[model samples]
Target: MMEAANCSLRVNRLLLDPKFESYKLSLDPLPCYGVELDTAVAEVKLRDDQYTLDHMRAYGMYNYLHCNPWSPDSVFYVDQLGRVMNINVTLDTALGKPIEVFRFPSDLSSCDRRLCSSIHFTSQDWVTLSDGTGTLYLIHILRNDQSAAGKWELKFNQELGDPFIVLHSVLYTRSEVQIIDALILSIEKDELDVEGSGFHVSLEWISITCSPNDDKYEILKRRNLHGKSVPHYAAIEPDGNSLTIISYKPFRFIADETNQPEEERMEEEEKKGKEVRELFKMTFALPEGAGRAVLSSGSVEVTLAKREVGNMWAEVIAGDTQGEFVADPAQSAAIAERLMHLTSEDLNPNPDCEKPPCNAQELEECDMSLEDSTTLCRFDGNTTKATHVVNLGGNQFLFSLEAAPELMPCFSLRHDVDALMWQPVSSQGDNLWDHAATFNALGYVQASKQDKKFFTCAPNFSYAALCECVRRIFIYRQPTPVSTVLYNRKEGRHVGQVAKQQVASLESSDPILGFQASNERLFVLTTKKLFVIRVNTAG
Candidate 1:
């Protein structure tokens, strides 16, 4: 990791040492330097005499041991020049063979293409990748060597959002199965019949086809007892569909005698068996709907049992009509029926009332008044008038009303002015947006959570004292956590002014680039390089 001075980088690879930490070095005064650790597969950079450090532990950049070696693993193939290699890490790891079994160009047709720079070993099959961009790629690396080909190509498609697959560790099974633990997925070897039945679980999704009579694994099942007890099972199908169901325990149920009396244990075992076979049946349905429906790509419509769910039933429209219903325990069926009735009447109102004349006052004030606007309301009640005067926050104000008398009591700071500011849009026939070579401004912007407005701090001498302002953007590799101060020849120091602020924490030696204040968040080239300590407004 990076420190504040005397730039030094270190890497190491240690498997069984709990006290073992990654290489550490100082990065205080040096511009650039590299150091290697025997336990690590990479080197570190030093800046400003400081260096940042990260672990060589699992999930770190250098640790690529995910999935069985015989199984294809997509890794960030690294080249000599710190670029992402266009090659894929394969399942084939035969001695003396090319570690990269396949590449896009095969013959280096495009040597300019980047070499692997970073890798995230996700599961036996899937991995989420990035080339330092905000965009992440979720790819599945599988062994297609069913034909015993000498080598296989690592191929994948880009996944739009965040990572897809998540990992799972412990697994459950039915008592009937001889083995209590079935490690369905692993990153290591197959039939891992180790001393303990437990195996690391990494849940990943891949396209697979099942043979007609192939063995099928039972995941979730529940058993009903004579009175109240029931057993439930949660399973994942070969195709990735999840199933949860209740089933009755079989007669061969065995009770753990260690925890119960011998005579009672036999009786309890029989009771458990009977409980497994009762009333609860599996009612297959979607686990949950999109929590709240919205108009995204299409109108909000929920289809259940091959029928469309009417909007009125969900309070989307004012009136209700007869439509298919989806039973939900959260909402009342009676309320749903009532809403449907209301929707029909509201949308299909009676045709007799003079075709409802439009309100001239509303039409004149409406933003679309020039068009044929329709009347939305008709007031028939008699009107009353009143007046009130009050002083608020040392300011006296008077207001008149033609409504209820309680309007006076309702006058509180509910609509009080929270903030005030002024900016010159135009001054001296020059627009503030315009700037000359001699004018420079560096302003600090902060967000006010209470008011929800981004406030740009007023420019002080920091902007005024500069000789000339150049609208230029520069990218520098910052490998230090400590803040730096930009000095001027005349002014002693830009007190209270930060040239660069690490919202939360900063690392001294980790190579950081392309960081912008507007889009806050430090980007580390790789997890092996540096693990940034981020700034959180909440804390």
Candidate 2:
């Protein structure tokens, strides 16, 4: 846990709207640091300072509400009438209120009140809404002056699925959404066993993706429940290939005792072998490598491939050098500079060479040419080593090969944790293709010589910003702590190093449903109230 001295936490403001209970909170999009509140019947916005209320409007009773994480200014929800509504905060109320973009059939019943309704904004203008009865509707919001001034138009509504009872749903990206469904089974054992009859839950995953055909969507994949535990949450890797599921709550059904007197059935169920199951959280990965991986060999050459049949393969091309690796761009530049300096020194071994080497101009020309050409630098396996795999947020990686003259860049792939291995491109096989064939097979139809200029030997600036934000929020919890400490998600560290008195006070007040964090601020929502806190951390 973080030490109290290292950071200070104080309540910035209480966002209390007595008219309705706030159940969800998210940050507004870029240029607006305000926070958005979802109260089922209305949407509210609080300014960055937390003292001022920016906007509030009642849409109606909604069974489900979801604010776009990337653009909180846009809110999507499912109304009581089974209609999907979109409220663009940027639009004026006089132009229109919440727009009814799509609606389900009148005969279809409202979603099961027991299960939470699903509404996810997959992108800025695309949304997926679920009525909880296995039906999903995709709505695309469009804006064009030809239609109307200041009026956004909704395109055709595309309906997909016959989903199971959706326990939870998440928009993996603009193109994919994953759904988890529960399958309950009843098992019978010997009559003498008191716990003979109980319920077993199996979970299933349904993935929905936009079809290649414009304006259409389809179920791309379905995974049946095969584990002993139930999955409660899931997140897709940035590459959109791997999935991680958090499982908990191993449960078994007991006799429905509503028919018997409550007082008589309570103790009877416990004594008759109905044991309570404790809740635990465990995470596991699923079907790997859905995205393509790219490896660059410092020159204008690069290889791109995908996993197939548990092996890494690339398209074959003629006269392609095999088993040859090249240095990354940065390393290649460094090598060229050193080689030029040595050649200059060797040609002019006199003290006067310090001022002007006899071959200085020749060396300079060689350096310039090397920048656009490939310098074959032999890699002695003993000296050249793949030292570290640097994770550039978004699943990109830089393979740091020490002692090698060049650097290598590797794109996104499912990391093998067991062996800490990366799939090497096929060196010698009939299927092995040259760089050109590999790129073409991966659908890089437009890839050309100029594309190599886009590859960087160093991490991007956005990655540095992410690291700085994470360093600012230092969240820490004590060993075996009971309460979860709230830290700025983007700024804090993983381990607990600090404790705030306000955290205990907040927990005592109500059960925390969830939280949203920006670089400097955090918004926490409980069952009854919402809190905006300013997180201050030591340098």
The sequence of per-residue lDDT tens digits that candidate 2 reaches over residues 398-494 is: 1110111111111211111100112112233322111110110111111211211111111111110000111121121111222565454564645
Question: Which candidate has the top score in TM-score?
Answer: 2
Evaluate candidate 1 by giving its C-alpha RMSD to the native, one decimal: 28.8
Candidate 1 regions off by >4 Å?
Answer: 1-77, 81-94, 101-116, 120-124, 133-135, 146-539
Estimate every model's Cα lDDT from 0 to 1: 0.23, 0.30
**Residue 299 lDDT in candidate 1:** 31
How far in Å is the alpha carbon of 283 misplaced in model 2? Answer: 55
Instruction: Find the candidate with the highest lDDT and give its number.
Output: 2
In order of listing, the candidates' clash counts read 69, 23
List the lowest-lDDT window of 10 residues for candidate 1: 406-415
Query: After aligning candidate 1 to the native by TM-score, how far in Å is the CA of 256 from where it should be?
Result: 48
